[model samples]
Target: MALTATGMGSGLDITNIVKVLVDAEKTPKEAMFNKTEDSIKAKVSAMGTLKSALSTFQDAVKKLQTGDALNQRKISVSSDSFLSATADKTAQAGSYGIKVEQLAVNHKIAGTNVTDPTLPVGEGSLAFDINGESFSVDIAATDSLAAIAKKVNEASDNVGVTATVITSDAGSRLVFSSNKTGEDNQINLTATDTSGTGLTDMFGTGNTTTLQDAKNAVLYIDNQKVTSQTNEVKNAITGVTLNLTDADVAKTTTVKIEQDNDAVKTNVQAFVDAYNSLVTAIDKMSSYDKDKKTAAALQGDSMIRSIESQLRSVASGRITAADGSSIALYDIGIKTDRYGKMSIDDTKLTKALSEEMPNIEALFSTPGQGLANRFYDLADSYVKSRGLIADRETSYTNQQNRLDDQREAFSLKMDQLTARLTKQFNAMDLVVGQLNQQSSGLVDRLNSLPGAVKKS
Candidate 1:
């Protein structure tokens, strides 16, 4: 870049003049551009904040809309040592005397001592029939006691029984244990061998001993005998399941099912808390500061107003309950204050839930028109694609882009202005230099012509 010639003849600062002029043309518009850009950015950030708050509220709304929070049930036990009980929504509120008789045991059997586990025991097949299902493991004369057990355990078609070899000073023996517990599930093994089989002699010679007997779990409910193949007993009572851990023939306990109050209260309170939180967020983004006389980023935003109004209408409207009865949020103690914030009256809510929980559940999960359903729908409108909040954010982003374009154009304009000013000022300086030279020549010519007496 060529340097600008300052006022050589006219003593003017040409560069400084160009700069001041260019700044004069640029300052006001630049300030406006930056101010508009900042405002748009602020609005974009505010929209994101509102969208996030809407999502949080929707998370709480989902539980109620799906009836998970409404239908939650808890289990209680009378004597945990002997038995435990779990109840679900289908369980009727009632009590029953429970007496545990005997716990089911798995069938176990063992063969007589084998001189050596590593020596071959048999040469054909050891077929096991357990719980009406049968599977077999082929044996070879060279198959050892350990090998037979391994073959049985590793057979892909084998069902319930497991084979193992037990070695002790008493001698080495092959043991079989049944996976299922029932009289019918007793371990029954059939041996077919070619070579003088060691297994047939150990078992066919009446050397196999029954280690434990297969028996069903027996319990007496109100003195009515009940038997199960497993410890867990279901549907002995409607929606109630009994889990037996220990059995005592002489001891008695009780199974009780009742409505859970604390869980219902907690769920209602969560909904209220979520609503209040959204209210706080809305207020913050749309509030005006009196001391500073400044409005917030989203103040007077029509979208925010519309969202709050729609949700408020849903909350205040009545829901058509299952029994053809209409119920409102306030009927269950969910009230909205003048500020449009939700609050709960604990006493009123507890009474409503305790007296009519079915109706309350219906109020929040009545298919399409419940409070949770309506709120989720409304929030979705604002948070989904092309939603009000999303559209607003897009608008602000577009504004930011346009501002950038204008700023670039303005920058080019300032550069042009500076160039023009510098050119004009330099031209003026040249003219002044020529004029000073012409004036000096005239004085010199006059001094030489007439008896130009020196000023001295």
Candidate 2:
């Protein structure tokens, strides 16, 4: 009456039975898939950590791969009040007595002042020549002193010249200035007028005052004279550039250049530190924990082994130059312990840097076989695009995708099984219900028979 046959089916708890059967099939497979996923994800994370360490180590290696960074120089100036100096790698390490004999200035010229700055000069043009470069400003018959200055200042083809009007109590004057310095850059200008030479009367270069002269900077290094077009003098010393600020034949400043040892040591230590950090990362990834009864994700992995082997091989490398200059990290006091960590002997390192810097440079920065060079290449192979670590991550991700696909397929199978079991139980329940109905009717009819009650 309550449709229990379709649902409970003679109180057999069919719903729970079907659920238990489905769970029994799903739980183990689900747990296995989850375990596999966890393992793959852990491996991917470990690869990430290793990649990070490798990247940092590569940065330090890049700093040492070039001889420029390692062969840097520091300068000492006795006095910067008068001058300053800069040097490059080719500059020899020594002291030089510098004397600032002269300083250079830009050329400037000004025409005679006019009583009325608003009066037009004439219909004409003015041509200017600085060094070999030439430009011209057309003067209109109605253009005044201020107007002429503006035109010259705004000329599209004007070469490095500035025109300004300075008004004093006596009168207003127009001035022309340019960066026409050095003896080669002579400054000259001329005016042509179509009406009664009025343009030449107001702004003639022949009568203009030489406000400033074009002169070269002169300096002396160790009693040797040097000259330059501008204040910045070059090649007075090989690989050195001197900046002259003020002239004083009597004031002498001393410039000294030497190897930047502290900076070099700092860089070397950075490389060592980065290498040790990467080693630590590798160790963690490959370690097995006895207490936890667990192993690291990358434990016993071939890629890890290959990377460690490469590091050891690179660490033990050596190079020898043509001038009997031979070096290894060992000669620079970098020692390897049993655990493959590097340590420095301070005294030995100091001595090596002081005496064998050239050999050290050759060891770490000499193009193909240097320590930094080889290490950088190795690191690139592991961490670059589609490289070792990236390939592993990609593979792990693909595995995850496949596992998800398998899970989806399993889910569909379980759904089908659940539906089939439900259908079969419902059919069997319908048949049992029909048989019970017939039996009850037969027993009732027997009980109602004429002698059946008397027997009861």
Candidate 3:
């Protein structure tokens, strides 16, 4: 609104003066608003970190609640070349002797070779019976050996038979094999011709060459006989699956299923690590730095203080055991230091695990009074949707939005004030310029009179 040559008329830096005055009014208010915004944002970030730490702690708690963690078993085989075994929670801890007598084999039959594989055999339907399930493939007069094999393989309802053409020094022989390994799963084929005798001439009604004989796997478990139609023998032993790789009648492999101490120890250590990390995060957020004269973003926050208090309470509390005794973490070799960090003693932990494992599990996994269950419930209240953390974040976001609106309104007011000040200064400069001109003219006129030029 003011003239671009602001100070040219009055010889005064009016534009700089207006800028200095406006800055003096605007800077302090804007700084206060920015500081409030930063503090709110930092609090929101700290809440997010708290939520993440709680989630990690909850995950660690979940591991101790499952039966698999408490009853884990590790299987060992003396000779892995013959077979390997896996044991589950239901398996009893014992050693068993296993002898592999024979492995199951699939039945395979090959038809006699022909002069030309591309030559059409005949228009017929080839039928097969596999494990009491019957299926057929329609053969056309123009269908070659390869085409017939493809048709047989493309049959969706085919139970356990696969057909292929094998090329040897003799010729390409169409072979059909049973996918299942058992005497009951033999592949028997019959051909019903319509036009020519090519089907009977090639494979002959009863002259199929046997490539492999179907047989059952025979084994001895602790000198007891066991037979299976498949190499994978399951249910022969409770919670154990024996996968036979080879047959060695003279050798016996010992399979030992025992409680997996290392696995349990690893899980315990993981829980300890998770707990320590969560405690460390909470401590940092809630602490004050006296040397720097600054407080953490979450310092003096009631919700954060409550969370830390509950977690520490759970860690220090005890649980009632099945023997009517109270068991604490320290009894199981898990101890907390002066700084509230937890650690495990390897030797002590192993001994406790061997002797008081059930009691230790009860401390963390007992139905409703378990330490893990309590921690899980507490953390869930904060990290869940529409929970404490979510509500706090929403409040902070509202504050930021209000700050943004205030900033916009403040800026508009400052612009209006600046424009008004500029216009006022320009009008004053114009008036001052006119006054100076009139004063100069009066001096000149007086000098034109007599004795006006004598004064120095």
Best by the TM-score measure: 2
lDDT of 3 by residue, 1-456 (tens): 233577766988998989998999999999999899889988988999999999999988888875467657899999998999998767878999999999999999988887678888888888999877999989899999999999999998888788999888898789999989977888888887888877776666665789999999999999999999999999798999999999997899999998888998898888899999999999899889999999999999999888878888988899997899898888888999988899998988899877876777788888878887887888889999988999998998999999999999999999998999999998888877778878999988988997666667
Scored by lDDT, model 1 comes in at 0.85
lDDT of 1 by residue, 342-442 (tens): 88888888888777788888889888898899899888888988887777878887888888999999899888888888888888888888788889999
Candidate 2 lDDT, 233-273, residue by residue in tens: 88789888888888998999999999887877887888889
Global CA lDDT of candidate 2, please?
0.86
Best by lDDT: 3
TM-score of 3: 0.84
Q: In angstroms, how far off is 123's CA in candidate 3?
A: 3.7
- Model 1 spans > 4 angstroms off: 1-4, 71-75, 105-214, 384-388
List of clashing residue pairs for candidate 3 = none
Clashes of each: 1, 0, 0
lDDT of 1 at 38: 81
The TM-scores of all predictions, comma-separated, are 0.83, 0.86, 0.84
**Preferred candidate (TM-score higher): 1 or 2:** 2
